[model samples]
Target chain A: MKHWKKILFWGLAISLGLVISLAPMPVKATSSNQKLFKIQASRFAFSPAVLAVNPGDQVTIELVSQDVVHGLSIDGYDLHLVADPGQTASMTFTAGQAGSYTLRCSETCGAMHPFMVGKLQVGGNDLLWRAAGLALLAVIAGVWWKRV
Target chain B: MFAPGESRLNLARLRVLDKLIKSRWPLLLARSITLAGFVFTILVGLLGSPVGSHNFAIIFVWIAWWTALKLFFIPLGGRSWCSVCPLPMPGEWLQNGSLLTKAQKSIGLGMRWPRRLRGNWLASGLFLLIGIFSALTLTDARLTAWILLGLLGTAMLLSLIFERRAFCSYVCPIGGFTGIYAKTAPLEVRVIDSDICKSHAEKTCYTHCPWGVYPLAMRDSSQCGLCMECLRVCTYDNISLNLRPFGSDLGQTNSITRLDETLLALVMLSSALSFSAVFIGPWGWLKSAAYDVGSTAWWAYTGAYLALSLLVLPGLYTLAVWWSQKTGQAKAPFKRLLADYSQALLPLGLFTWIAFTIDFAFPKFSYVLQVLSDPFGWGWNLVGTSGVSLPSALLGAAPVLQVGAVVVGLFWSANLSQRLVAKQVQPARARRAILPLAGFSLLFSLTMLLLLLG
Candidate 1:
């Protein structure tokens, strides 16, 4: 490979990585209208494994434990609640994230407690597209380096 | 064939490192410390609290040690952990009838290892079996202890039945992947002068190689356990620990092409994907099925897991290799092509494991500290750290780290594929031959990125 080509190749790769790393994340806009969900937590799973909503929605989650004490915590969202058996624990927050965030069981319930998880899809996520584009760029870069 | 820019710097020229490798006491002392820790881990697992987070066995073994192994050891020092692994210590001592000295006579049956059961086939199968049950073992203290005990028992039985670390060479599951990834590590134990080894008639190095590797013929670091036995036994002082560039051994085709190792690579890649889905993905049904051992759902899950690992991933890889062969107009056999190209996945597999470990182990590191103060969760507060709940600040940087790892792995594998194809065909055809495998590697990277960031 030529020296200039190597420099160009690395420069492009670093730039692409930087663009992907520094890309501005789309924030979820707050709205006055509210969306309510009542979720039931059992021994090893939740009632609904996936919750999909549009951006800018004020989401209110009413969590009730069906068996023992369970806690619901969502990553990328500061939403956490603990509910005992037959009791409803509610939390209201704006769903402002435009990606998939993991909803996990916070409390140690049983043997399979660590595996108990759900998904919250806020809106159309662009991170996947950017990642796919970066991968494609890598292949092209590899081919170019080989030819040079 | 070797990489173009590869070079080795011998560490034997350094006085301290040479003395350390030449002497027997340092390695013995290190192994003894690890053995003590291993015994304590087993005891805690058997008698400690059932909670996975609060128990020293689960926290130390699964979180702390696992993280260090994946993140630092394998990449920096090939088979370094195996040098100090305590599982084979009892078996080795029993076989040699000594603790810190060289053996005068064989202690076990000393039967020849069967030729048919050689290679990595058994180790690959054992690795898959362990992976299938890892969901259960990683979370349950009792199960983890039993698994450790089972490994120790198997090692001892094999040592008594065979000779000279046969269990590690043929059947150990961790050894299977460690040997494969060790090729990419920066450290290697090799003959400083091959001519010296060839001219020497006695072949003293072969007699001391516990891993059954011949230093004279060693062109790669895959089979060497880095135990420094050859270093201690070399009469001419020909053995030297050399520092080389990472991925230096990946391009060496002399020792890397094998069907069993190819399958092991594919299995490791597929297993990483499946583990990520089961542990980190937001899917409750998959978790339930994996957790339920004997249920119909679990059976179905197992079926899917086997199909994906043994058939689907290998099938896709075969297709890619066939496409590359057709493009390159190579005359090599299909099996040869499959084996040769599979080496490209080593970097990606290793980095995927590292990325997965970063995601899985980092957030849970607080458990390590928690267990330190109360190893058995008996409210001991030994170190006044029982109430410590140090939240990980690494969550925000995890996605970037994962993406970087995947990208680096993709490029490294791509370079390796290019070199491998060039060795097999014309340089112009090599460019075309590398495309299919490079595409496959890129696709895998994209999939990993999706799993990590999307």
Candidate 2:
């Protein structure tokens, strides 16, 4: 085994790991995009299923319950907002993560309570694209290594 | 260069490990505990809460055991779980008319499995059946119990009618699931020297194997159940519980491939993709359609499910192989190429499942603990822990875990696909051949990443 090649492989692997961890959140935003989303939560469905906001934005979500009691808890954003029937609850947080975070129903709303989900995209789901790049790099590296 | 089994570290060489495997008592004990637990789970499912999370049957079977089976057992031990699988316990005992050892006379008719129904065709069908009804069967406690009961009854019936473990070898979806991915695991049971086994006049190992695997012909870990019966009955002391490199059986030049096994691999891939979409995905319409059995929505869901698994996914894979053949200008038949290149799907499928299990079970892990205190969910807190639930185990780390797992799988698959192509074509042609598979794998990995994180 070539020590330099081994070092290169580990370096590439570590780079991929770093890319996955920090891909979604890129360099600190120079300009912030502020946006407010009023999402309707009803019967295991979220209105405007995909909410897109740029990174470094003051994102405020006004969660309105059309029926029953529901909660909005973003996976990356720890703040959770709950709304009773016909009521609205709001949560404001800085959109720091750039990946797609699932907004799940924190409270049991119905039979499909466990699966109540919506997507929160801050900037873009750059992880997917970065992952794709790393995947190709991996294949190329593998082929090159196997040949050598 | 080390030969396949030659490179393997023989665990059976250690006296304690050898003794544990050679003795019948250890296996019997494991089977008994799982069997009793299985029976109890059935009873509880019949007489338990309608809510899925509170029900022991749903929690343990779908979330707990299913998660463990994918994330731990299959990755670590191959068919190690099958060694102590409880569904075959009673039937196997009846077949041999003995609990611990093989009887002089057996009860089964000793008939052969139908040749047409052999291979993974039946197993794939059985797996699709489970996949299509997964919503109802996974959630409803009574339905879950009935499915287990049905599988038990079928295993017993098959054991009585056929020679040995025919259901597991041919019909059990979980068996097919394990058997197909077992090649990726590090642990394998192989003959130390095939010549030794062939020379021995009394091949007691073959007769004793419940899976009917002749150790001499065991080229891979795909068929052997890791039962250890061969180890005990090997008069020549030829059987070796070899710990080899992970995925040591994959992409082998001498390995045999078949259309049936290839289809099984595709079915597994499709199942993982479909499951990720349905179970962990935020699509309410899909979940509702899947759960509402016999409804119009469900019919549509079934159609989409079947089409995804049967037509779309398999069609893409076939196209990849066709592309590989066309580009490489290989002389092998298209059908043969399909079988050979399909090895790329195994690592991808296995890791996809591990990621899916992580997403599906992380939040519901609380259900496992909650049910432990109240198996029947009749407001009985036997351990004073009922209604207590923990937060999601991985929390925000799940996406990271999911992404990491998928990337590793894609890398492995890419590596394997290149080697598989190189086995046939010249280096230049191999490069062209590998492109399509790499593209296919990369595309699939992105889709999964999108589902998991995007």
Candidate 3:
């Protein structure tokens, strides 16, 4: 490799490493005791698209279908239920996972049924941070392997 | 440090693989089975319930076949799927005027294909158009049926008008990207020795290759459809199906580069990102905009989609290339550098597609079983699995898999970029040229990670 190319390669690699390692840690808030939320499902959307709660919180959800029959299925949780039009279904569970889980429509309601999605954010979401760190490590290791 | 052509394992030397490749019946049988499946999918889509999840047309085509092509086929077999793809079968049969036997003469009009339409521009444009309307095609059973029927009809028409496999070569949208990514696949069709090919009087392999690729001068896997035509026609037994390292073609400098293919690569990467956002992301308005085709919001969405795929992504890549050249003090032409560096995107593009596939397919895999029992959603339980609803247990591991995919793709691309630069400039200048390209790959990987994990 040419002199400038080698310098730029190592320089960028080190800078990337420092930036990732020195990045501020994600804020972890204290756990809340209890929370109750009502989520509404319509033709192809959820009213409360994002529901954020602390880990270990006792959460109660009232899901209502507005226009048609729709089902709510949340990833990382065994919560799958269908609600008919103008009907409300109730469920309660303790939020234990510290990550973001997708809440999607289980039933095929319309042409956009596959894309009807929401997010359930619980606690600190350490997984995202860990993933970022792993990605940086993988890049550094890859560059090093090429050099070797 | 390693040289090209260092590690290639010939499958022709293997007893069973050789037997299968040399035989006429195995490929025919595979193509026949897929043809039956293709007919079944189209029929069910046209005649079954409009509900996508309950219908076999939607479930089998979108969930099962799409997943298989992305997750397994392209990664392991390259354009091996094209060997058995049913789309070109009817056209080939009609053109040859034979079902199982090789014809002494083809039966087409033999009109020469338009010279300007020779590249992947049409395929890329068609692919972008399809991506623009994927919201409807993936969900509406009737629309899916129409698209499939349209592809089959076009293939037949083109075969009748022109000579060999024009649809597969430059018209099919699916073939466009598959051919590009197939270059990264470990499997390749190549000659055992170029010396024999050079001295041979008759070029039987070139004449028989349906995809218009000559095995003697074949340096890349992009054009070879793995149809096994060359293997049969090589009287000297010079052709061999080899298992090679992944991204081997991308690392070499001898391969021809085209702007359309490079744009296709960026389009694929952008499409993957856009698909994840529209389908998997928690965005309701985006979904509504995408689904409502003629609405004002849909037009806005389309504008944004085109801008992102055609302009923004390529603009960013151009900037990286410009920076690399400026910083490295290299004197290579701008267009040449642009094309060469664009090849580095293939690894990342393919793996990002796999990541997206894992996210989309792994969750709804049980639907495959449901549709198997009740194809038309008519309450018939033919296979006793109509009521089964197995949840996606792989959800927890999905993020990790996606991260691994993007990360692996980034590093592989970075390595290839470095190799590419080294071939053009001095060692130090090559390192400088590689830096910006590496940074670009890292940035793209980080963006993908954010989309996937965040």
TM-score of each: 0.93, 0.93, 0.93
Model 3 per-residue lDDT tens digits across residues B104-140: 8878896778999987889989988998998888888
**Candidate 1 per-residue lDDT over residues A30-134, each given as its tens digit:** 455678888899966777877877777888889999998999987666667999999999998888747666677888787777667776777765656666766
Candidate 1 Cα misplacement greater than 4 A, ranges = A23-33, A50-57, A76-79, A94-100, A120-123, B1-6, B255-257
lDDT of 2 by residue, B1-454 (tens): 1345367788998889988998999989999999998999999889898777678998899989999999999999999999989998889999999999879999989899999898999989989999998878887899999989999999999999999999889998999979989999999888777788778987898888899998888777888899899989887787788888899989875445588888898888888888888877777788888888999999998999899889998899989889988999888777778888888889988988888888888877777887999988787888877877554324677776777788788878998998989988877788888888888888787788767766
What is the per-residue lDDT of model 1 for residues B182-272, given as tens digits with 9 covering 90 to 100? 9999998877768888789889888777877898787778788899988888888778788888988777655345898898888889888
Better of 1 and 2 by lDDT: 2
Error of 3 at B320 (Å): 0.8
Q: How much lDDT does each candidate structure score? A: 0.81, 0.84, 0.83
Better by DockQ, candidate 3 or 2: 3
Q: What fraction of the correct interface contacts does each predicted structure contain?
A: 0.40, 0.41, 0.51
For model 3, the stretches where C-alpha displacement exceeds 4 angstroms are A1-29, B1-6
Model 2: how far residue A35 lies from native, Å? 4.8
